[model samples]
Target: MTRLVVVGAGLMGEAIFSGLLASGWAPADIVVSDARAERRAELSERYGVGSGEAVDAVADAQTVLLAVKPADVGGVLEEIGDRLAPDALLLSVCAGVALATLQAGVREGTPVVRAMPNTPARVGEAITAVSPGTHATDDHLAEVTEILGAVGRVITVAEKYQDSVTAVSGSGPAYVFLVAEAMIEGGVHVGLPRDVATELAVQTLFGSATLLRDTGDHPAILRENVTSPGGTTAAALRRLEDHGVRAAFLAAVEAARDRSLELG
Candidate 1:
């Protein structure tokens, strides 16, 4: 029997499967299914995993993972809903799709879980938020935590908070990238070569994030630690505040949250 069947061969799907393999899942126990034959062939050649149509992939599989786009969720579920074995776990990483919607698509009492994982899963450093569906129990959630933990940190949140999680962590990476872009450009403006600026910005962000994580210090406390009275960091922060950067971020997260609600 197949242990896991991933219903999409996209980036996140590939990430989870690759992470699993890296953590010791055998190739024969996993199968990847994609709508495009070329994609299916590419992953099979690259990873040496089995490939098949979605329906065939899920057969006798203990877990079915849906990594498709939100728009494709309904269709994919429709194709495999009734086909899933009664005890099989259905897990999804599609954004903006609700548990009710997923549970409705599958057979009655089928265990479903909704998860929001960011792009960093590609590097095994993602922070994923998972919420259980109506039929999901503690055992099912523990299984999900183990599966997702292979890629990154897994946090269980109430389903009601998932939209907020979608806004904060799911969309958070893009915001960090934008900040990195601006920082690199700022370095260039200060007479650094583009490559030098790029390296500095990347390392600074990385080091700062590591510090924040390792020290367990509040971000504000960390910022204050670096900002001497009337120093460069202080000057920069003053300018940022003058430009309302903090307010902009609040607005941005709220906008993302509202959009997620609309999508759901």
Candidate 2:
């Protein structure tokens, strides 16, 4: 039997496949499916994995990864619902779509695991959150975690917390990029060359993140460490606070959470 079938050849799909390969899974053990023949051909050439129609791909597989767009998920599930092996595990990465929705589309009692992964998965640096459906067992959740861990960190959360997870991490990268963009522009406004500003902004973000991760320090403590009394960092931070930057972030995350709930 095929060990895994990834039912989409898009960015995240490709990333997960690549990560699995990097983590020592044989290409022959996996199959990928895409609606576009060209996409299937490209993935086959790029990864040397088997490619075919979605239903055919999952027919004998032990695990089926549903990576299609949220709008397309229902149709894909309907196509493969009856064909999926009775014991196959269904793992979904469709954003905003709930486990209830996935459970409704698949065979009754199918063990569905809903995952929210960010764009950074493309680089194998993503943090994915997995929430189990009513039928999913601890072992099933563990299996999904192991599969996603091939790419980056994987955290298990209750389904209720998934919307907040979607907001905080699923949409988190764009927030970081916006900050990086503003920092780069700010550096340019202060007379730095654009290229130099870009490097500075990028490295600063990278280094700060590394520091926080490596040292296991609270972000506030880390921020305080760099902020001297009446210093340049202090002045900048004061301006950000005066402009309600912190509150804005809070509001933005809440809005994203609300939107995620609406999507579900």
Candidate 3:
């Protein structure tokens, strides 16, 4: 029997599989399932893992990762619930699906964990937030943390706070990409070549993030450190503030959080 069964072959699923392999999991120890035969074939060919029907892939597995779309999760659980080993952990990355909904579809007392991971998982730098269901134990959460830690950082949060976590980190990558896009365009507007602008914008974002992570300093302090009185940085920041960029971000995150709640 496989040690882990991934029930979807989408980008996040592929990222998790890649991360696990990078973390030294043998391909033979993992199995994958997808609705499309072509996707199954692709994953098997690319990762050298076994591929089959969801029920077949999950049978006797130690852990079952439900990486399917939220709309499809119910059907997946209904199909595999009985087949899952009694002690197997059910770790889900289906956005907007609640633990109660997942538990409703599975066998009684089956441990369930819900995770919200961003696109950065593709690059092995994601920050995933995990929450436990009614039956999930501390050990189950730790197991999930270890599994997701293969991709990046993992933090435990109460189920009630998951929607907020989803809005901030789950949809956070697009916000960063939007900022990078604007910065690149701003450089182009200042007469820099597109390629040069892209490199400068991308590297600046990367370096700034690295500095913030490594220094443990407040972001305001970092901003102040870079902004000399009446300097270019100050001028640019003033324009952003004048345009209510911060307020816009606040509203955007609230909107995202509201939508996540609606989806659940």
Candidate 4:
């Protein structure tokens, strides 16, 4: 059996297990650990992976998924650093934790893969970006990619880009939601019913994205295709420019990236 272990058993931890299983790995081959007794029991009952202690769960796992919080990763890695299998791979979903920090806990020279996945993964519509540490080989990365890609689209970037990835895709969902919220309010302001406004705004966003994705045209081109001179879109664009929306997005993402670096 191809043994895989997931630590933390939180939302992302559990989501990782679910993603692996959906990608064809059997429950018998996976193990999960959580510090809280209730979480362990709950997950074991739900997924059938035994609710063992962290060290026990990861003891022989071929790939250990570090799904703990950014702050907790160091301690967990330190705790199990010496106990992991010599050749086992380390995969982490904890944002802001650097590759070097992860390698410090595991066996010397073990492979490590770091990933940033957004909240949409809960519904299987996530976008994730991954970067490998120095020890991670192509084959090892492929394995990690396969696991993360199960939940959504996966992109591989340099670790140098992970912080930006965190700000964009990782924090991007919230930005989209905020836009949706504003659109819905705008619709309501214009006399549309709340529910109808929400549905229309959401569907428009989804349809626009779908069209852009399916048409294979660049976003700039697709957007230009929609905006006629002196059109409604152009009017909205002027209002958005007046409000400095684009600048706000740049500032927000840049601030998030800086904060991620600061946290690490």
TM-score of model 4 vs. true structure: 0.95
Residue-wise C-alpha lDDT for candidate 3, range 19-102, written one tens digit per residue: 999999999988889999999999899889988998877877888999999888888888988888888889999999999998
Where does candidate 3 stray beyond 4 Å? none
lDDT digits (tens) for residues 126-212 of candidate 2:
999999998899999888988999999999888899999999999999999999999999999999999999999999999998899
In model 2, which runs have C-alpha deviations exceeding 4 angstroms? none
**Over 4 Å off, model 1:** none
| Root-mean-square deviation of every model | 0.8, 1.0, 0.9, 1.4
Q: What is the lDDT of residue 122 in candidate 2?
A: 81
Candidate 4's C-alpha runs over 4 A off are none
RMSD of 2: 1.0
Question: For candidate 2, which ten residues in a row score worst on lDDT?
Answer: 117-126
Worst ten-residue run, lDDT, model 3? 54-63
User: CA lDDT of each candidate?
Assistant: 0.93, 0.92, 0.92, 0.87
Clashing pairs in 3: none
Ranking by TM-score: 1, 3, 2, 4
* TM, every model: 0.98, 0.97, 0.98, 0.95
